[model samples]
Target: MIRILFFILIVLALGAGFAWLADRPGELSLIWQGQRIEMSLMVAATLLASLISAILIVVWLVRVVWLSPHSISRYFRARKRDRGYQALSTGLIAAGAGDSALARKMTARTHGLLSADQEPLIHLLEAQTALIEGKYDDARKKFELMADDPETRELGLRGLYLEAKRLGANEAARQYAERAADKAPHLPWATLAALDYRSQTGQWDEAIRLLDQSRAAHVIDRKEADRKKAVLLTARAAEKLESDPKGARDDAQAALKLSETLVPAGLIAAKALFREDNLRKAASILEKLWKHEPHPEVARVYVRARSGDSAIDRLKRANKLEALKPNNVVSLATVAESALEARELQLARAKAEAAARIQPSEGIFLLLADIEEADTGDDGRIRHWMNQALKSPRDPAWTADGVTAPEWLPVSPVSGKLDAFEWKMPVAQIAGPVEDGNVDMADEAIRSLPPVAIAHHRDEPVQKPVEKVVETPVKATAPVKVEEIVEQPAVKTIAVPVPTESVIVPETVKTETKPAPAKTEEPVVEPFFGRPPDDPGVRNDSAKPLEKTTFRLF
Candidate 1:
């Protein structure tokens, strides 16, 4: 709007000036080549303006005529470049779509139209096509060539790293990743790969440095960086514990400071402190750890912190630990074990029972058995507890990837993952119950024993007991006769002879009545609980036969 106004004002000023000149009617005179001429001022002014306009038109025409060929050449070049770019774009799309044929064709056309030096994307497209065709060698060469160019160096390194990983070249992959990380520290993949390489190779200090770099670059969060650093520090401590206890102690302390919940770090630091005779410090660390979560190793170490301490002292220490984390299975078990060692049978039995109630496990049951044996020297109670121990749920251990370990480890041996081990129950395989027939046979064996035989096997005298008899089903073909003999106190004993050719069915005694051919009668062997009377648990190779035996209560 302002330009329009200014143009109107300029035209008005020119008109007013022309009108004023006309009204004034001034005369103009000029002498050219000794000839004198006179004309109106307005005519000379108009003629001057016309001549300037004509000069500008001629100059513009001459310039256009001279530069026409170059303009035409540039237009054609631009058209070709546009076509090449179009092919490249299409090829990239096709490559992403997994169309190898179209991508290959577009790659060839793009190469023909655009110079590789001028169009870097053309090289990328070609490499992608080679990858699509499974031409790894060609792809590798293309990426290597790209790596030489500063503009694509990081991208090239990433590509080469992936290829190296695909081909299982660990060293090559690490080199590429390190190069990429050097070029661009913020690249998450490169930083992570370098970090993993350093960690896997036990270059923990280097790994920690890379982790810091990653955190600075915002590739990893502060929490994650701290966690990874803790893991690395703990691992380093474990590595150096045997050789350099001081250094290991420092590392472990640092790790525990970062993450107190880390069991390995706590254990390692406690161990290092103990080795240095800093018993109070080690106990302090373990007590703090026990407040969060109770661990058996921590309890053991805490109890053993002062090696000169007696069993009663250890028991007091364990009680202190249990007080920190009340009702925990580890705390209870530790207390129970300690009490048993201290000959505090009542306390041990109570703690063991409490531990079993909290988490029914084999360890707790075994501890209970120990308590029972120590408190009451009865074989029956001991055997009962042992059987219960065998049937109890398995105890928690350091488990990783389905593998259980008796001791804690910083990493999983199977997967090589840091802090992989966890204190938990191992996965148990599912098994179906025993067959009904087997269960019935076992039940029948227990029932078939005479009352006198049962009483004779017991270590204690029997009180007045009620007796129940279970009838066995017999086959019609084989019938056996039972002879009864009356005994004192309204007791009676019955004995049944076995048929020669009959199989014993414990649940339902069935016999075949069919008699074999009258041949020399061999001594009949009755099946006692599905075995011969004299058969030991193991099979014997020696053969002895023809001894007939009668059933007796003893």
Candidate 2:
């Protein structure tokens, strides 16, 4: 638009000049050596414009003729290159679509038209075709070629890493992952692969350094970095505790600073401090850890922090921890164990039973059995609790990645994952759903148990508690006939055993049977579902009160 407007303005200016010249005409004259030429100013300007236009046209024609060969060759080359690119695109599509035949065909065609040097991705297409055809050797070779080139180094490393992982060559995979991560830490697969290998190999310091690098590169967030670092520090501390307690303590303290609720870190730190004879610091660390997340190990370590403390002193310390985290099953169990060690059987029984009521498990039941044996030496009661322990769900242990460890660990044994162990019931230990109301029922059943009159040493006589007069429940329907109520004399029959045969013995009844019609109903007798009346196995109740009868051992 500007060009057109400027052209219009120039034409107008020329017309105005011509008009001005027409009004005062003048001729421009040119003189050569042998000839003279003359023309008007307007005529000379018109001729000059015509000559410049003709010159431009002639120069355009000459340049076109001169470059025609090169232009033709360039046009054909562009067409060939376009066809190769089209084939490459089709081959990539087919590879993604899993059409190995078409991909290979296009790959060959592309190779015919273009070399790997001309298009780097042709090598990738060949690799894809080889992979789809199950020619892993060829694919690996192609990847190696790509890896040797600077342009496709990261791509080649990624391919090599994945292929190595697939082939189960963990060392080669780690090498490739480290190479990729060293070049670009932003790659998640590379960073994770390198970190996993480092952790699995127990290179704690290097693993920590790698984590720092990854955090700085923003490949991993701050929270994840701190968590991984804490695990690494804890593992390192555990390894160093025996050799260098000072260094181990520092590492564990750092780990605790990173994650306050990490129980293993707290335990390690406390143990290191114990080795250093820093009893106060060790106890303080354990107590803090217990408050955050109460663990039985923490309680045990805390109670036994002092080297030469008596069982009584340990029991007191256990109680203090229980005060910090009261009513917890772990705390209660720890205290019960310490009390048992101190020979305080009653205290142990109370705490253990309380813990069982809260969360009944094999460990608590076993502890109860131990208390029973210690307190009264009651074999029946002890066997009852021992059987219960065998039947009850197993207690919580340090489980990680489906493998249960006897103790806490910073990393999983199965997957090498950090911070994996948890203090919870193992999956295999779960029986089924347990009613929460069972605790109340169990308490009632235990209370109803008759006190055992165990004999003491030196032939001391044991005193038994007074028996109560208990009423037996009667479940029956009354007769519909409206007859006068009459009491029928009925004798309770008890089965008596004999060496040869069994017989029924009559016993006196204190509680009256429910009233029925005067003459239609038979005398009410206790129903017995035993062997035939003459069976030798039949035993008599001997008219003993329910309280005096040792009915069930458990």
lDDT of each: 0.76, 0.78
> Per-residue lDDT for 1-554 in model 2, tens only?
99999999999997897788778767998999978999998788778878998999999999999999999999999999999999999999999888999999999899888878978999899889899899999999889899888998888889899899899898899999999988888988888788888888899888899889999989898998898899899999989988998999999999988988888888999998888788888888888888887887888778878869999899999989889989888899999999999999889988988887777778988898887777776444666677667667788789888889998777688876667888888865433324565466346535643344354422243443332322232222321122112222232223222222323232334232222223536642322223334433323557443332121111
Clashing residue pairs, candidate 2?
none
Model 2 vs truth, CA RMSD: 12.9
- Structural similarity to truth (TM-score) of each candidate: 0.64, 0.69
Error of 2 at 155 (Å): 2.5
- The TM-score between candidate 1 and the true structure equals 0.64
Candidate 1: worst 10 consecutive residues by lDDT? Answer: 508-517
Best by TM-score: 2
Q: Give the top-scoring candidate (lDDT).
A: 2
Residues 1-554, candidate 1: write the lDDT tens digits.
99999999988997898898888887899999999999999998888878988999999999999999999999999999999999999999999999999999999999888898998888799899999999999999999988999988887898899999899888999899999988899998888788877777889989889888889889988887788789899999999999999999999999987887888898899899889988788888888888887878888888878879999999998988888888788998998999999999889988877666555666776776677666654443455556556655577788989999988765577755656788877866232123444334324423332222222322344344434455454443544554333222134433443454544332212121112123446643222323235323333437453243333321
lDDT of 1 at 411: 59
How many residue pairs clash per model? 4, 0
